[model samples]
Target: MKASRWARAAALLVLVGFTASCGLPRVGPNKREIYSGSVQREGDAFIVSVNDRVTRATAVVPALGFSAAFRNAGIVGSDTIRPGDTLGLTIYENVDDGLLAGQGLNATMLEEVQVDGAGFIFVPYAGRIRAAGNTPEAIRRLITERLADQTPDPQVMVRRVAGDGATVTVTGAVTQQGVFAIERPTRTLSAMLARAGGVAVEPETARVKVIRNGHTGEVWFEELFEDPQADIALRGGDRVLVEADTRSFTALGATGNQTRVRFETQTISAIEAIAQVGGLSPTTGDPTGVFIFRNEPEEIAKQVLGRTDLIGAQRLVYVLDLTEPNGLFLARDFVIRDGDTVYVTEAPFAQWSKALSAVSGTLGLASSLASIADNLNNN
Candidate 1:
């Protein structure tokens, strides 16, 4: 029993030494800038302070939801004829009427004509016809007029059978990325994406960009499905790009988890943020010190203090007190932006607990070692 006590004392001393020599995250030598009083609103571009009240404007992120930030471009122009196109032509003449049956052919003559490098197609009887920059309907009219001289009441049908001139290219973050054809007046952006097997990931965390006529525009992935106006029309030379967005916020301090959370959705609530990290540590967390750090807009900042600070006070801090019953409901309604920091302070008793535990452990080790030494001396 005496030997066992000595061994336990040695082991306990080793453990205590190891803990003392090393540094833990929040318990290390690093001084928290929060307590330095450096966060002042006067003459500073970036500022921080206590904001106990929640406002409608600051509590919501619209672009992640209804998207008031996204200005709809509305419906746009669609595909038009271009070079490198093939046309399917069908000519119909009354075979039984015996009117202009000079060739004695059947009721219909089917032909596939490819537009030449000069943007013209040659029909056997109609001669070279300009098919580029003109719709199939316009081509049919021109062909019918030309064939009128050869046969009475000539009927001509023209349609684009194959063409790169009327298609858009879809690339990036799609299962089957490729060029897709556009046949109607509507924007083919969504259809092309569907044909390419949709986005690789969910639309909530993706972004889409459109490049057309030397101009480029971008929108949130969910905008395409939620707002019809966001699906801008696809021109023949248009390019649609889809990309995954790994947006996230960091939860630190006395919360359940201390890691980054990727935002799969456009927005996340403050209450949800707390639950994600495993909620506040029941023993060591300060329920009244929950804080969210973010960069406030200049316009809103102007409203808050009436003018820009010398330091450009863009930094804003939000505090929530969970002890209050209404704070829970308010937290649920509060929205958190990307890259925001959620921190919970340590409880008042946390330091006392650490000190008491350390002292108790040291005294117990000294007592065990003294008892073991007494047994040895007596022997």
Candidate 2:
């Protein structure tokens, strides 16, 4: 009976050992598995070791800007007239009974003279005059010349009042969103944003976009204050939009948290990204197998790998060994882009510990069964 018990115990030990050698349940792939999935090893991903060279080569800062046409555009005249504008005209004639005024009056007041869609405004005897594309002073001169031909020494004074001409539409993430007239105080992009009650989102992450004549342009909100060149001039019929930044990276594997984390600032480093996710998991994280997965653009891939033959975006796996001498510095300098994945592999000893615990539990159950059989036989 003792010999049978020993044989069964040995068989159970072999079964547990076989199971442990085959595999154990894990949260993610190990370091060896990740390395085996490299392109050099016939895998679909390219693996690059993170170092000073890689950090320098991949240090890309994402920025928004306008095209040359938008940036180099001259500021528009605020007093320029356009269609749909309201002109307030005051006409004074030398004769007591003028064509525009009454028999006893010498001045004729025209209120709310709306410019038509064809950029023309009609007067009592001045006929139809082109008002759009001309300033108030130019329109006054044109009206005076037309009335001089009918009346004696007619003097015309044209002033622009509240109108819809040369206006910009401001919307999204602002204190007030509406169509605003382009006055002298709000002629440029920055001035217009201020007149619209400023940006409602955080300035660090605010993005401003402008669409004019189907050509679109974008810029960082902070850049408008920091760089004068970024504050492009606004045009008539311009649509301005302000919004928050949407850049983020996914944190997975043996980290403190597993989720998509947003960028808290304009630019973030790898160390900052790891800290954002609550750092690595002390129990299961392998300090030498921190990997960053990203799809590098063709031009960036060429610069990073020093190879020019690469086409399109390439899948890249950047390995960071925190155990190295300068690993922390490299991580601190490496830039984390918008749609990246930060993964930390499990330690080798962690898997071994799991397998040992499983084997010990199975052996303890076998011992309990043997003791039960011995007690029954004695009875």
**Candidate with the greatest lDDT versus the true structure:** 2
Give the C-alpha miss distance for residue 169 in model 2, angstroms.
Answer: 1.5
Model 1 lDDT per residue over 154-246, tens place? 877776653556667889999987766566533556777887788998877788887777767777877877777676656666788888876
- Candidate 2: misplaced stretches above 4 Å? 1-23, 86-113, 122-164, 363-379
Question: For candidate 1, which ten residues in a row score worst on lDDT?
Answer: 24-33
Best by TM-score: 2
Angstrom error at residue 55, model 2: 1.1
Candidate 2: residue 22 lDDT (0-100): 72
- The regions of model 1 sitting more than 4 angstroms off are 1-33, 38-54, 57-80, 84-118, 121-128, 136-164, 305-313
Residue 331 deviation, candidate 1, in Å? Answer: 2.3
